[model samples]
Target chain A: MQRPLDVLGSSTDKRIIIKTKSGDSIFGILKAFDSHINIWLDEASIDGEKEVKLGKVLIRGDSIVYISPEK
Target chain B: MQRPLDVLGSSTDKRIIIKTKSGDSIFGILKAFDSHINIWLDEASIDGEKEVKLGKVLIRGDSIVYISPEK
Candidate 1:
């Protein structure tokens, strides 16, 4: 069975869309993640009520809802 | 430092609202959880597009966005 981390691991270095609890979506390239699911992303940008360029960011795990790999 | 799990540990046996990736908020009494954040809840109910009673449920962690203790 693929574990949650395993799924995320597969998406590393790939473009993924992360839906957050604050109702914001982050588009970026997955870089790294820890056991807590805290993620490091590059070329990130907020895509929601307020749009902004976020070159790189480490999103707290709890703030994230789901991570979907871009096709 | 309080980790994500630490926050959840404090909410054990308490009423909590879990926001999920599916855009549903689950109201329940926290029971147990694992490292993966997979949670077991009692008296679980969905509060979103559709409402339903779920006596007991184990929610996969990745599907969860945030867990808030009911005030």
Candidate 2:
């Protein structure tokens, strides 16, 4: 059984979607993460009615609800 | 600065609200947690249009968005 981190590790460099607690959907290429789940994303953007480019960002794991590979 | 884990550590035995990726709001008294953020809650319940008791539960951290002290 793959652990959450194992899934994340396999997702590195792949496009992914992250849902935030504040109801924001973020899309990005997963770059890196720490034990706390703090994530580094490349070409990150706020995904909504209008996608807003955010370039690169570090997302606090505490603020994230879920992370999944973009389908 | 207190890390997310520090916040959770301080919240032990305290009533908290956990927002899940599936848009569920869970309320409970925090019992324990591990490095992966998997949480144990006592007297757990789903809070929404109608409250539903869940008794004790182990919440997978991957399914959780944010955790906050109950207001």
Least accurate 10 contiguous residues by lDDT in model 2 chain B? B1-10
lDDT for A48 in candidate 1 is: 73
Cα displacement (angstroms), candidate 2, residue B11, comes to 0.7
Query: Could you report the DockQ of all the candidates, in the order they appear?
Result: 0.05, 0.05
Segments of candidate 1 deviating more than 4 angstroms: A1-22, A25-71
Worst 10 residues of 2 chain A by lDDT: A51-60
DockQ of 1: 0.05
Tens-digit lDDT track of model 2 for A1-71: 76878878888889999987767898888877777787766677776556767665555687778889987
The alpha-carbon deviation from the true structure for residue A42 of candidate 1, after best TM-score superposition, in angstroms, is: 27
Highest TM-score: give the candidate number.
1
Q: What tens digits encode model 2's per-residue C-alpha lDDT throughout B1-71?
A: 22336556677898877757676778899999887778899999997778899999999987876566654
